[model samples]
Target: MLTPSKPFTRRCFPAINVKKGVVMVGNATTFYDGDQKQRNVTDLVEGAKKANVVLEARQVAMKIFEDYTVSWYWIIIGLVIAMLISLIFVVLLRFLAGIMIWVMIVLLIAVMGYGIFHCYMEYARLKGTAGSDVKLTEIGFQSDVRVYLHLRQTWLAFMIILCIMEVVIILLLIFLRKRILIAIALIKEASRAVGQVMCSLVFPLFTFLLLCLCIAYWAITAVFLSTSNEAVYKVFNETVCDYAGKTCDPETFNVTNVTRLCPDATCQFAFYGGETYYHKYLIVFQVYNFFMFLWLANFAIALGQVTLAGAFASYYWAFKKPDDMPAFPIFSSLGRALRYHTGSLAFGSLILAIVQLIRVMLEYLDHKLKGADNTFARFLLCCLKCCFWCLEKFIKFLNRNAYIMIAIYGTNFCTSARNAFFLLMRNIIRVAVLDKVTDFLLFLGKLLVVGCVGILAFFFFTQRIRIIQDTAPTLNYYWVPILTVVIGSYLIAHGFFSVYGMCVDTLFLCFCEDLERNDGSLERPYYMSPELSHILWKKDAELLKSSESQS
Candidate 1:
């Protein structure tokens, strides 16, 4: 049985190569499939998943590609309705813009007038008999006239001169009207672009209600912290408390801190028993509520993202073809997200949350190692941190695109992600170009919105301040309004810009899908909305009639 060249067959992987007599191929890592071909579980699963995704993608392509009625009656009716609505909206927007411009001018004038009034008060106050004893309550807690006693005529003179300088600067702005007009022109263009997809942003108005819930929850959490910290410290005395061995008071224990209040014998005898007090308080004060917030927050984020994706996808389909655009697709999308995709949304969100948690932990570790003196060690740690940070960002981008596919194809998050990733990889260069362009435009739009809002809010706030300027010495950090304006502008800008961003992403996906499934040549036309195809590929639109003929 044994020849010189013969080798004995021994045990292969028992798990993978189930049959003992079968020769192990390669490293014996693969098993025979139903077709008697060597395959791995990963390969099998991926095959099945990708197959489903392809089918789902085909279903989307079919629905969007199908030819609809070109009947004259529907066309005329839709056009007339759209034209009327457009005219009404344009007129209303014009009126609103005019009103807002005038309102801003009036507010600016009022702020300047307050400055003039403040100058007058300073002038009068300096000349008064009690001028030296005039209590400047703003200066300090010495509101008993000592602050006023320190007020000099030179200070008053300086204040008056400052007011005059401000007035002069305002007057000088007339010479810069041309520059202002140019800026306004740019703003107008951005606003027009924003308006093109603003309809898609409507759903965010309702979804913001969910954001409100998150805010309320945070407020409650803050109150709990303020309420709990004090009570926990005052109610419980510093004792040899260890609940695991039943040494600590049961009544004092919070559920999250059960381990602390009821400690194991090991911790009870540890030298670090003193650390337990703070650890227990941290559990009661922070740990319990934080995890609950994460769960709620994750759900909210998932639902919000799905809603946005669907709205944008519907908009992408309906964008240029007003006739094909349904009455309100946001409602349809919300219905789909809530009814069909809730589970997938949850699954995707959980993965995102896990990655986010790891990133946070890494960040904490990064902070802990702040002063690490070993250069090589520091470099290695930095590289490790950078790797994970980039990974998080990449995952976020992938998930966003995946959600778009989910909205369109109604696939699970994992399947959608795989489809999106593969499609992107296949056309990486084009995707890169499109992504760069979209991001730049969005950044500019956000800048325009935030800059304008901040200026408006600043003037409005200043106009509301009393004219006396007596509060200058006590002015709330001088930058309070600036800070408030920046934050508010950022939030509003994000809300508006997010919709446009979604539109770009959704449209790009649709465009890619169109290219893949349909030959844009004459006999095989694009499945994209009529207006989109015409506008994007102007000269080629003549192919439409031929496509219809073929169909």
Candidate 2:
């Protein structure tokens, strides 16, 4: 009884003590009794900020280090330094050259003055030698001597003037060196850029030009084949009949008329193969007759053949070697080929047109020459028929292998002819002797272009000597130096441009590769920050995990 009363009243050490330090079983607004939790939360946020700052600093340093490591950047810096050094060198050279040029000019003037004085003295001596027979003879000799002296003096004066001028020019070279170098550099850079651009555009341009020509050819064929252009047909018919030199009836030439003309042994022998051979012979005869009637046609065919061959040869040469491949040269060859082909085609067409006109005129003449028979008139009436046949054959040939014709036209007829010969030899030699003949032809073509270019350069240098003389009288005596400098300058410029063009071409190719790798999407970030990169990786990982878990 005493224990139950005491337990209720006394709370003695309490069976259970509820304190603020202890956490509650149920949800409560405040669980901890101290500020430790709040302090820990603040410390965590501050620590995170400090860690982020440290990471950012490290990332920045790493980026800086990486940027410095890139080869292109260092290369660019090195190139800049090199360019600066070259500029300084050029400037110094120019200064020295200028001084020399002035000195040479002064020397030239002095030499000229001396020559004039000597010539005057010679004249005075001649004047003093007149009178006695001895004196007279002496005077005559003196007169001749004076004339020679004068000529010598004049020549010497000119020579001295030229020498001095050359010296001056040599001195001025210091100044010109910079300009020359700069021009060369610009040319090189431009050439490289141009080469790359040209390479990119070449295929499309070639295709376009080919299409244009093909369309034109087709249109012409269509027009000629049309029933409307019967006039062209009439001219062809009349020319053939004139070539035959007889008013022979079509009945004799016609398929049905063979029975009447085959009475003789010669006719029987000619007709031995029957109608098929007769038809073939007639076709051949008509073609020959048309070609013969128009000499220009032969020229066109020959030119076309030659041009096609040349183009093919040039293409083969251009693609033969990896190191030899240069955009400018390829483009230049293409341009030259196009130009030559166009000119040849235009000239050929003009000539052919003229021939056709002449043929028409001749037809009129023959019409008048003949007794104006209705049979002749009938042949003339079928003029469109002959033109249609010719046009159809040509179109067929073109359609079957327009590529060959286009290639020839693009490369120029000359190149085309060379390629044709090479191909022919390749085939013939392969069949008869060896297959390596093609390699020989390829080598030959390459050698031809290279050798031709070299020879042309030499020829130009030689011819420049004359040009220099014409342009600068003072340069006559210093021909060697002047010519050397000019040629050297040109070569340097050419080489620089060529190298620059090649570099540009290579760079463009690299860019193209990059594009291809990017799959034409070009929109993804190219540059990334370390922090962003890390975040992206983390996000990616999280997404992957979530996806895997779902699966």
Question: What C-alpha RMSD separates each model from the true structure?
Answer: 28.2, 45.8
Q: Candidate 2: minimum summed lDDT over ten consecutive residues — where? A: 229-238
Clashing pairs in 1: 243-261, 243-262, 243-263, 244-262, 244-263
Q: Give the alpha carbon lDDT tens digit for every residue of 91-155 in model 1.
A: 33333433433344445445556556665675566665555544455454431222443465535
Q: Candidate 2, residue 400: CA error in Å?
A: 13
Cα error, candidate 1, residue 238 (Å):
21
lDDT of each: 0.56, 0.37
Q: What is the lDDT of residue 282 in candidate 1?
A: 60
Count of backbone clashes, every candidate in sequence: 5, 27
Candidate 1: C-alpha lDDT: 0.56
517: Cα error in model 1, Å:
1.0
Candidate maximizing TM-score: 1
Off by over 4 Å in 1: 1-199, 215-292, 318-320, 371-380, 456-474, 521-524, 529-531, 534-551
